[model samples]
Target: MFHYNATNLPLQGAPGSLGRPAKGAAKKPPPRRRRVTLYGLTFSLPLLAWQLLFFLAPLAFLVALSFWTVRNFQMRPDFDLVNWATVYSNPVFWQTYLRTLVLAVGAAALTSLLAFPCAYAIAFKLSEGARRWATFLMVIPFFTSYLVRVYSWQIFLSDHGIINALLGRVGLGPVPMLNNTFGTMVGYLTLAFPLVVLLQLFSLVFVDRRLIEAAHNMGARRLRTILEVVVPSARVGLVIAALFCFILTFGDFVSPLYLGGGNPPTLSIMITDTTKAGQQWPRAAVIALTMIATLLAAAFGAVGYAYKGRAR
Candidate 1:
């Protein structure tokens, strides 16, 4: 019998050997992950640069401007709290802020409520071709200038406008629609409704048809299915739509001015008024900062709510 000692044998170039590489052999390739990360960073650089240049720089300047002093209609770069103090102390500023907040919230709520049904119909009821056409039509509003559209609305919403003229025939209304909260809401809807509907439609269309079918098979009615299943599933889009509506309405100048007649000025109107009154750019900057803060809070809160549960 032959006794073989495997451990005593030479291991170099042997099958499954743990020996080091030969002198002339290539070193192991570096990790692809590091290369991939580098590529991603390279692609993202332009966007980062753009944001830094346009958005962050302007935002920082606006903050600095708020702390600046205005003397004889000229902005003087100074570290002063007078602008903040004056804005905070004024009852009118607070009132305008509150009014703007209320109106923005109201517009968001109203626009979402109004847009949902339209979106649902487009998503679930329409054929593919019809859906495409409807979407195209929704986009058509954007082709015309928003200012032009607002002006056009004036012709229809005014006291002696076509709507009121028709209403007068029925002895119904010369209703005070224009130059009020109603007009402001109308303008808000005009701006946000189509966009909201499009957002909701996209969300709804991507929903699992199987889930909807399962609900139907389980004896869930339309309204119940919508409230329980559809709404929950599409909550992110809906909330985002409402958030956009809030942001747009909050910052809108045209609607409140042209339609609402600037009777009780909003924050945007206040900014203009501040600048116009005495070129109080610092005060305006304070208002702008306040608005930016409010918007950021609302956006963060809504996004948090939208993505409340499930996986990370």
Candidate 2:
């Protein structure tokens, strides 16, 4: 073998050498990265435009409306704190706001309680075909118009309606149902239960069945397995379900308007009443902004909880 100094060895492609590329070398083309980025931007444009037009633009206008003053039942362009002051000063508004919070929290809690078991059964216990059927049944109620469902509930809860009629036949006087907190909550649950159950079912279906089986084999009881293993695993879904219920119920005017009376008015109803009575757009906007702020805070909290649970 001919011995050669490493420093004196001619490099590849040196003078009089064959210009072959070094083996196993790779080069990335810059345009490939730009193409990928361009593809992502192209796909995202529709969604971005939709949000800007329908959500952000409307929200911006609403915020602007909230700051403007309303004078003589006509909206004035002058910015003032008067609308906010009126909202804060009114005791009735405060009472209504608090009541709305109570109703939303209460309904969400109850719906969660009712939703989890149904979702668990559908997700884990049922066969695939059975799960599909059960899911369909859960959504069937929603196929009916929302307003029609609310009106149906109104009829069902009325003094002479189906529930009261059945109760009266059992020798009990017609319990107060329509235009009360109880009735309002029932209506909220009726509308929200389907959504809650669906969300929770979607969550539960993705949970590893093997983990649940392992927990069971370790002598965990049914309730313990669910509480410790299943619930923790599905916490994100549970949070989403509860958040949806709370947000929907919090902003619902129709249920409280038709089923609940003035004694326990919700913020949505209060906003409507204020708008109808005075055409006070700015004040209404303040109330709207308050509700928006509250829901946003709730959304942030739910997202934070979900992400924290996921992180763990």
TM-score of each: 0.85, 0.83
lDDT of 2 by residue, 42-81 (tens): 7778898999999999989888887888666678787788
Q: Which whole-number lDDT from 0 to 100 does residue 248 have in model 1?
A: 90
Which 10 successive residues of model 1 have the least lDDT summed? 29-38
The runs of at least 3 residues in candidate 1 whose Cα sits more than 4 Å from the true structure, single-residue gaps closed, are 1-47
> What is the per-residue lDDT of model 1 for residues 112-228, given as tens digits with 9 covering 90 to 100?
999999999998899999999999999888566888888899899899999999999999999988999899888888888888888888888988888888999999999999998
Q: What is the lDDT of residue 143 in candidate 2?
A: 69
Candidate 1 positional error at 172, Å: 2.5
Cα miss at 301, model 1 (Å)? 0.3
Largest lDDT belongs to which candidate?
Answer: 1
How much is the lDDT of residue 236 in candidate 1?
Answer: 90
